[model samples]
Every structure is written in C-alpha cells, then in structure tokens.
Target: MILYYALLIIDPSLIGIFINPFIVQFTIFTRVYFIACLLGVLIPGILFAIRSIKSDKPEINLQGKLLLIAFISFTIGALLTSSIPQMTIKVIARLILVTSSLEFYMGYLLPNWVKKILLKNDN
Candidate 1:
C-alpha cells in the first residue's frame, strides 16, 4: 500500500490517465491520496482483530487490544483534524509513529512473553 502511494506521487499523470474523469484537479488527487493512506493504515487493525478472533490461543489476544487502541487513536486524530489547521500532516506523522511502536512491541516485547507462556503451558 505504501508502495502504491509512492507510485501515485511519482506519476500522478499516469494514475490520472487511468481514472481521468474523477481527478479533474490537484485537490481531488490530494483527497484521494489521503483517503488511500487512511485505508492503508486501517487494514492492519482490521486484519489483526480478525486473526485474534480466529486463533483459539488466548495468548494471541494482544492483537485485539491493539486494534481497539488503533481505532480510538484514529478517531481522536480525525476529530483533531477537523478542529486544527495543517492537521493532516500531524495525523499522518502520529499514525506512522504509533504503527512503528506497535510493530516494535509485537516484534520484540511480545515474543519473550509469548515464549514464556507457551513453554509454561507445555509443562
């Protein structure tokens, strides 16, 4: 998704050619770009929640919690965007920061605890 966004930025003219009628002005492209970015951020939250639900292991519940946090943060950021000028940049920055933090937590912090729990359960 990020790669797609990059492509859009690099060649807006090429992209516009595919969907020419919809993108009359630069503002429309900007709006579409932002919307795509928002959806890209959202996909992981939804996927994580679904994975958490499907997995029987109770230890996998962290994904659901992260999803909730993501949703709440997104709502708050959206509200702030409406009230503040130049909020899109702030919101995007916040999203990236939060996403990276969550990825780190999942990659590093969760692994040790998950291993410990699985090992304990095995015994």
Candidate 2:
C-alpha cells in the first residue's frame, strides 16, 4: 500500500474542490514518485514508532506535535491563499518540506534502524 501510493504523483495538485485532498494526481511512471513521496512522509513515523516499540520506551509525542504544527500551518496557509496562487504554492511547498525533511533524515541518518524494523518479524 505504501509502495503503491509512493508511485502516485509528482507535482500532486491537491487543490481541487470535491477531490481536494481526496484524489491523487498521477501518471504512468509517476507511481514511483508518489510512492517515494508517501514513504517520505510516513516512513519516519513508522520507524520511530517501531523503535520505541522495540525498546519498550515509546516516546514520540514530538512527532505528533510537529505533524499537528505542519497540518495547521498548511491549512491556515492554504486558506489564506484563497486570493493568491503564489501563496498557495508556498503552502504546498511547506507541506513538501515537512515530509521531505523527515524522510531524508530518517532514511539517511537512521538507515540501519529503519532496515532492522522494516525487515523484522515479517512472517
């Protein structure tokens, strides 16, 4: 499921009315991009949660807080951008920033940890 979503869309235009935040803009080969993007956004959360689970010391309240901040910032920014296209773009860019940063840091700095959990107990 994560892999499928990662290969979804490149420049996802999640700004439509009825389809807003509901539909994914994708292409043929773009599935990989969307999958990557999805992984970028979620892999961090999964890994963090797993590590805590393994250590028996769950403590990622900060992730939820940061995620909440990101959501609030994106929502407010997009709402304000109702009158400006550039501002809307800025809001989307910020959303991308939040996820991409999480992905890169986790995938890079904590590669071993992610691999260990991702490969763990998959029967």
Candidate 3:
C-alpha cells in the first residue's frame, strides 16, 4: 500500500511532469483536470489505508465522488490529448482505476455472491 501511494505521488510530480514535455505545455485548465484525476486516485487510496490501519475493516460505499472525478478526468484528458502515447497512458490509467476500484469493492462492498465465494465455510 505504501508502495502504491508512493508511486501515485511520484508519478504525477516527478515522472509525468518530467517525462512528458507536452504536459508542461498544457493549459491551466488541462493541468487542473489532470490534478483532479490524480486526486481521485490518491484520495480513495488514502481513505482506504486509514480505515484499514485503524480497524482492519472494509469501507462500504467505496465508489464515491472521487471515483467519479477520476473517471471524468480520464475521459476529458483522453479527448483532449492528440498524442497516441498519451492516449495509451490514459488507457493504462483506466485499467489501474478499474483494478484498484475492484480491490476496494471486494474488500468493503461484500456483495452476496462474492461473500459466498469467499466465505464458503461460514454458515
């Protein structure tokens, strides 16, 4: 978890800005949109970590405002970017979002079928 958040911090600040020169050329609106996307990932990760560290329990209602913000940011970023590489990165980011969101869901949401599969021995 620490590694994940560390990457989140590092990616946008150090790697994204430095590695992608076009990012520096982006308008302020675009910059804010990207920042919002980063916040989307970071906020949920922070909340999940805090809740886990405190009680080792899952948090229901995992899909909240942050996830929606992340989704919208990604959509806008993809639409605005003309570069194929940037578009590819957005695609990868989307995959990461889905994977992490699934982690949150399975951990906290506990839908009945998933619970049955995970707790087959429990009555």
Candidate 4:
C-alpha cells in the first residue's frame, strides 16, 4: 500500500516553472512532505516491531489501519524520496486505494472467479 502511494506521488511541477507554479513557500512544504514520508515508513515497522521489543513480556500484537500502516512503512523503507508534499500525498492516497483493491481481490473476487470457472467447466 505504501509502495502504491509512493509511486503515485511523482513530481508534477518538474516540467517548468511557467507550466506549474504550484510550488509556494517551498521550504516549509518540503519539510512537511518529508515528515509525511517518514511517518509512512515508521508507522508500519513500529507496529510489528513490538513483537520482540520486550524479551521478558508476552508479544503484543498490533491491530489497526492496515493500509495506513503499510504506506508509512513503505515510504520509510524507501532508499530515497522527493521533498514535494503534494507528490507525497498523491502517492499515499494511491497506495491506500491499491491496498484496498488488493485486499478485496485476494479475499473475495479471486477465489470466487476461480471457483466459477471450475464450476462452469464441470457444467
């Protein structure tokens, strides 16, 4: 999911300044975007990372936003990322959608389609 969002967030204003003046107050926006990306990476690992955080205590499993956590992990896991806030948001949104689509496909549609095909052949 995070991978989906990160890829979707390509820089739109790279063509030319005249073509797109969307970049304003460049420094602050850039920082926020960086933070968002960092969050994307950290949110996931931190969740599962606790499985071994305390050796003496029982494992504490996490249960929450699957996609959001995945996206955070994806963005953080990336080796490099652009500082563009808008672009980062684009990627994050897309990642969430893609993750949901994948969940749907895997849990319901894929199995049903396969079963339907087999049943049709039997008929």
Which candidate gets the maximum lDDT versus the true structure? 1
Candidate 3's TM-score: 0.37
Clash pairs of candidate 1? none
- Put down candidate 3 lDDT per residue, 1-123, tens digits, no spaces: 454456557664432343465433443444565666667766665665455546532223333333444444444444445233464665665565565556555554556776555443433
lDDT of 4 at 42: 62
Model 1, which residues run further than 4 Å from truth? 1-26, 71-83, 86-100, 107-123
What local lDDT score does residue 11 receive in model 2, on the 0 to 100 scale?
32
- Residue-level error in angstroms, candidate 3, position 29: 4.1
| TM-score of each predicted structure versus truth | 0.43, 0.26, 0.37, 0.25
Candidate RMSDs in Å, in order, are 8.8, 12.7, 12.0, 12.5
What tens-digit string does per-residue lDDT give for candidate 2 at 32-77? 4544545565566555544544543222333344444444443344
Lowest lDDT 10-residue stretch of candidate 4: 57-66
Model 4's number of clashes is 7
User: Please, what are the lDDT tens digits per residue for candidate 1 over residues 20-107?
Assistant: 3322333455546656666776677667666774666655665455555555466456434432345455567567557656654653
lDDT (CA) per prediction: 0.54, 0.45, 0.49, 0.42
What does the lDDT come to for candidate 3?
0.49
Clashes of each: 0, 8, 0, 7
Better of 2 and 4 by lDDT: 2
